[model samples]
Target: MGNDGQSVGDRRGGLAYYELEFADDGAVARDTGLRAAVTAGQVDDVFVFCHGWNNGADSARRLYTTMVDLLADGLARHTPDKGARTAVTGVFWPSLLFPEDDPTTGRPASAPRPTGGELAAGLEPAFPGNKDNLARIGVLLDDKGGSDRLAEFHERAKKLLTTPNLDAGEDSGERAAAELPTETVITYYSGWSRVDGQAAPGLADPVEGLWEGAREVLRTLSYYEMKNRAGQVGRGGLGPFLSTLATPDGCRPREHLLGHSFGARLVAYALSGLADGLVDGASPVKSLFLIQGAFSHFSFNDVLPFDPGRGGALSCYRNRVDGPLLSTFSAHDRAAGWWYPLASMLKRQDASSQADLLYRWGAMGADGYQVDTASRVRLAEEGFPYGFTTGGFYRLDANSVISTLQSPFSGAHSDICHPEVAWAAMAAADLAGEHQRPAR
Candidate 1:
C-alpha cells in the first residue's frame, strides 16, 4: 500500500503511462515523476484516471492500462497525428474490498459471518482509534447478543462514522437514521434484504441472527467512511497536485479527468480544490468523465428536487469544468442500483412508492445526473455521432454496452474496460481540445 506511487515499468501498449499515488489523507507521495514527464512537453494531452473501491495497486494498474490501451488504439486509427502526444496517469489510493455474494443465491458462497476477531481485524485499518469499540463489537458478535447489544453496536459504529461539528442537513436519510431506534434500523435492513432476495425463506427470525445484522451495520458505516475519505483525498491531494501542474502564465497540457465508482466522487471533489482563479483560465483539466459513479445522482444539482432549499455538495462547482462533464449510468450496475441506495437511505418516511425512495437516494451510476442542466445520450461505438459540445453536462445511457452480469454484488459495475467506453472519453477530450483556449 505504501508503494502506491511506484511505476510498474511495463506499458502494455505503446502508450506512455505513469502512476500517481495519494495517501488516505489526500497527501501526494513525493517524486512520482508524473509531473516531470508531463511538463517535459512531450505530452500534449493527459488522461488522469482514478479507480473505485476494492482495487489494490495491481488491479488499478490493470484497469488504467486496459482503458489507456483502448484509447491509444482509437487515437492511432482515427487521429494518428496525436497518438504520440498523449499520456496516462493512474491514481492509486487505499480502498477496502467488501465480501462478494453469489449471484444465483444472493448469499456468500462460504461462511455467512466471519469470526468476531476476523471482522475486527478486517475493519481496523478503515476505522483507526476505534479499537475499543471494535473489540466490543467483536465480543457482541461472538456472543450473538440481543437488542441491547445491537443498540450499543449502532452507537459505537455511528461514533466511528460520523464527523463532529459538520453540517448534517444535506442527507435527510442519514440524519433520520441517526435519530432512529435500533429496532427500526434492523427492520429496514430486513426489508432491504428481502427486496434484494437475500432473505431466504424459513431462516431463523431476523432478530435471532443479530450478529449477521451487526456485520451489515459495520459495512454500512464503512461505506460512509470511504465516501468521506474519497472526497478528502480528492480535495486535499489530487486537486492541489493538479493545480501545481500549470504555471499561472505558462501553457499546459490539455488534461482530462476520469474516475470510476467512488473514484468518481474523488475526482469531482477535486474540482472544489482548484485555485479559485484557475477554474476559468489556467485550469489544467479540460473535461471530466464519471464511469459507473457510486455517489448521488443529484451531486451537481443546484436545487435538489426533494428539498427546495438545499443543493448538492458540488452544485456550485459545475462551472469549474471548463469543458464537458459526462457520466455513464446503467440499469445493470446493481452496486449503484441496489446496495448504494439501500445502504445510503437508513430510513424513509414518505407514503409514496418504493421507486420514489430509490430515486431520492439513487446513485449516479444507476440513475445518471438528475440536474436539469444535464442532457441524456446513448453510449455508442467508436465512430458514432455524439455531437457533444463544451460546457455541457451529459448523462450517457450505457445500459446496452455495460449490461454484462459480472457479479451478483457488483453487477456490471466493473465492466467498463471496453473499447466503446474509452472512445467516449477520447471523444470528450477531442471536443475540449477543439475549443481549447489559445496558449498564453
Candidate 2:
C-alpha cells in the first residue's frame, strides 16, 4: 500500500527549507539536497522530526515549519552557544497510504473518508488549517448518526487488529516486531500522569461517551498503520538518511529527536533500530522528546519476565541515549485517553489495565511510562522540567506547562506551536546547556 512513484511531494513553505519522503517500499523518494549536504559535510547538526496521523507531505511541511520555529526559538534561549548549523529533516512514510496506488497512473484509488469531515471538528481544533473538519462536530456531539459511523470504523479496526499482516510490512525492524504482544492487549501508560487518578489500565473505558469510541477507532487504526510505517521508515529510509547526514568529517554534530503523536513512536522505534546496530554504523540519539505520543506506554517494559530477557524497543534505546527521554502528555488529548486504548485493545483482550508489571499496554502520552523498575523523574514536581539531570526517563503534564502558552480555551492537543511547549522540548532535548534563545 506504499507509494513507489518517482516524484516526491512539494517541500516548499517549511522552515527547514526542504523535505524528504519515504515510499511504502521503504525507499527515500529523493534527497539531492540532503545528499549534497551530507557529502559536503554542510549539515553540522541534525534535528529530525516525524508527524502524526492525517498528515500528508504538504501538511507535514506546515507542521514542521511551525514546530521548528518554536524549537529554534527555544534552542536560542537554552543554548546560546549552538556552535554550529543544524539540519532538520521531516520524515514521511506510507503509513497513511492505506490505499494502493496505481503504478502506471500514479494515482491512488481512494483516500480515507469519514462521515464527519474526518474528525477534525469533534476533537482538538485550535491548530491551524483543520477548521473545515469541524463543521458537523455539533451533530456528532449531539448523539445522532455520528456514533454509528464511528462504531463501524472501530469494528473494522478491531478486525484489522487481528489480522496477522497488519504490522507485517517489509523492512519492519526487529525492534518493531519485538514490541508486539503475543496477544492483543489494551492498557493505560499509568503513572502519576493519569488525569482520572487511576493507576490501573483496563478499568477505564475508552468509549465512555459519544464520539469517544468512534474517534478512538480511527485514531487507533491510523496509529497502528503509522507505527508500522515508522519502523519501516526508520529501518529503510530515516535511519540511513540520518547515517548519511551524520557522517563525520571535522566534528560530529549532536543529534536530537522530537516527535508529536505517532511521530513519537517513529522516533523511539528508529532509535531502537539504530542502537541494535540495525543501521550500519549509526550513532545514538542524544535526547528524545515525545510530545503526546500514540505508542504503547509499556513500550520500554519487559513483557516476558519469565524469560528474563524479553523486552521491547524502549529497553534497547534506553541505555544508548546520551540524554534522558523526555515524555510529555496532556490529559485533554481525547485521542490518547480514548483512541489509544481502543487501538491497543485489539492487541489486548478485554481492554484491561490489570497486569503483573510484566507487559504494560496503552499509549505513553496518555498513561505515562509504564516501566515500574526504570529510574524516573516526574516533571510536575519542583525544579523538575529544568532539573533534567542527564539520563533515564522523565514524564511531564502537558496541561501544566503547555497550557500557559496557548489561549486559555484551546484544546491542549492542537497547540504544539506554543513557545512554552518549545521551551519544554528544549529542556527535554537536553539543549538547555548554556543556550540563551528566547521563547518569543
Candidate 3:
C-alpha cells in the first residue's frame, strides 16, 4: 500500500474478497470462500467493491480495507442504534497497470503521475515493464507509415468488437485479446496519428517534460482494458458469487456496490449482467455508490442512445434499487472530466463536436444525466458529501469539496476517501435499507 488515502482506525471487520482466477478463455476458474460462506449462511450485509484502473491486488485490498473501515465508522455515526454490520468483498480482476518501458537508459522510466502531496497517493509503483511495451508500440506506429495506421486500428478494433455481436458469430476469449493491446492502441491514437482535438494543456513533451503522455497512454490502456474486462466478468464470473449472495434465505444481508473510476464502470456492467435477478426483485444489491466515476453520466439514462441497444449497463439497475442509485461527482476531478470522454471519443471517432462529443465524453462528476426529473433533488446545503436521497437517481455534487474546498490544483482524481464522503455513503445505504424493511 504505497499511498493510502488517509490513515484510519484498524476496524476492518469481516473484510473478504473472492480472489479469482480467470481461465485463458476468461471463465471464472476458482472462487475461494465466497460461495462456501454464502452456502453456509455466514454472510450478512455484503458490500461488493470493485477498484478502478492502475491498481494491483495489494493496492485494491488496502483501499477496500480502508474504505470499509471508514464506512463502518460512518454507519455508527448515522445509525448507532441499528448496529448492522456489512461484509466487504473486493473483486480483483486482471486489470492492466500501464507500465511504460523507456528506451534511453534501457530501463523503465517512471511514468509521470499527479503528485499533489498525500491526496493523490495510489498503489502504482515505479515499474520498468510498461515502458518497454510502450516503446515497442511507438516503434510499430512509426513503422506503420502514416495516419492510415489509425484507420487500421479502427477497423481492427471495430471488427473484434462487432464480429460477435453485429455479425452473429461465436465471440471467444481469444477474440477479445486478438485486438491490439490497449497500450498499443493508445500510442497510435494519441501519439502521432490523431487529426482532431489536441491533448489537454500540459508539459509540451510527455517524455522530455512530465509523464503526462505516459499517464495519458496508461489511462487510455487501463480504461479500455477495465471496461472490456468488467463486461466479461460480470457476464460469466460473478454467477457463483452473486447467486449465493442473492439467495432467498431471508437472513441474507442487503448488498451495496461501490466502484471508483473504471471500477464504477465495472459495477455498472456487473449490474447489467445481473439485471435478470434484479428485475425480479431477487438481487442482492440494495444501492450503488459511484464516487468520482470515470464513466459516462448517460450510462443509466433511459433517454440516451445506448451502445448495446438494450440500454446502458445501469439501465436495468434503475428499476431494482431500493433507495437511489447514488453517485458522488466532483467537478474538480480533472482526470474524469478530461480523460474519460476524451479517450472514449478518440476510440470511436465516428462523431464530430456537434454530433455528440459531450455525450461521448460523459463524466458523472462533470455533467449529471438529463433523463429523469426524479433525479432533480434539491442540492445539499452542506459541503463535501452532500446528500440527496431522491429514492431514484441521486447525484451528490461534491464540486466544493474537490475544487475550492479540499483538493489542490492538479485535481483530485483518486483522492476520494474523506470522512464526510464516507458518512454520505453510509447515509445513503441506511436510507436504502429503510426502504427494504417493513413500513415503520
**Candidate 3 Cα misplacement greater than 4 A, ranges:** 1-26, 29-32, 80-84, 100-222, 246-251, 275-277, 305-313, 347-356, 374-391, 403-410, 431-440
Q: Which ranges in model 1 have alpha carbons more than 4 Å from their true place?
A: 1-12, 100-113, 162-179, 194-197, 200-203, 247-249, 349-351, 431-440
Sorted on lDDT, highest at the top, how do the candidates line up? 1, 3, 2
**Can you give the lDDT of residue 149 in candidate 2?**
49
**Tens digits of per-residue lDDT for model 1 on 1-440?**
11333433234455677778888788876435566655555667778899988625677777888898898888877777776667788898767654333233244445454567667666776667888888887787677677788888778767766432111234334444446787776555545453234663225665554556656666666666777778888888888888777433466778889999989988988988887777654577778999999888888888877778888888877776777789999999988998887775776643266788898888889978888878899988888756666677889999999999867578889889988898889888873123333221
Each prediction's TM-score against the native?
0.87, 0.62, 0.66
Per residue, candidate 3 scores C-alpha lDDT tens digits across 235-353 of: 55553346445334645556777777767766655665553555434566667777777666766765445343444445545655554577776767765665455555544432466
Worst 10 residues of 3 by lDDT: 163-172
Consecutive 10-residue window with the lowest summed lDDT within model 2: 183-192
Q: What lDDT score goes with residue 48 in model 2?
A: 73
- How displaced is residue 137 in candidate 3, in Å? 2.6
Task: Pick the winner on lDDT between candidates 1 and 2.
Answer: 1
- List candidate 2 segments past 4 Å from native: 1-18, 95-223, 247-251, 275-282, 303-309, 346-360, 373-385, 402-411, 434-440
Return the top candidate by TM-score.
1
Better candidate by lDDT, 1 or 3: 1
Top candidate when judged by lDDT against the true structure: 1
lDDT of each: 0.73, 0.49, 0.50
* lDDT for 26 (candidate 1): 80
Q: What is the C-alpha lDDT profile of model 2 across 1-440, one tens digit per residue?
A: 11232222223222233356767545778553554554455554556777766434666667777866666665555564552355566666544422111122233335332344434342222222324333443244334444454434334333333212212121122122124431211122211122222233323643333343343333444345556666556655565555444444534445677777767777776664452442212354666778777666766665523234555545545654566567776667655655345334333432245352212345666656666544444444212346454455667666665432221111344445566656655665555563322220
lDDT of 2 at 146: 41
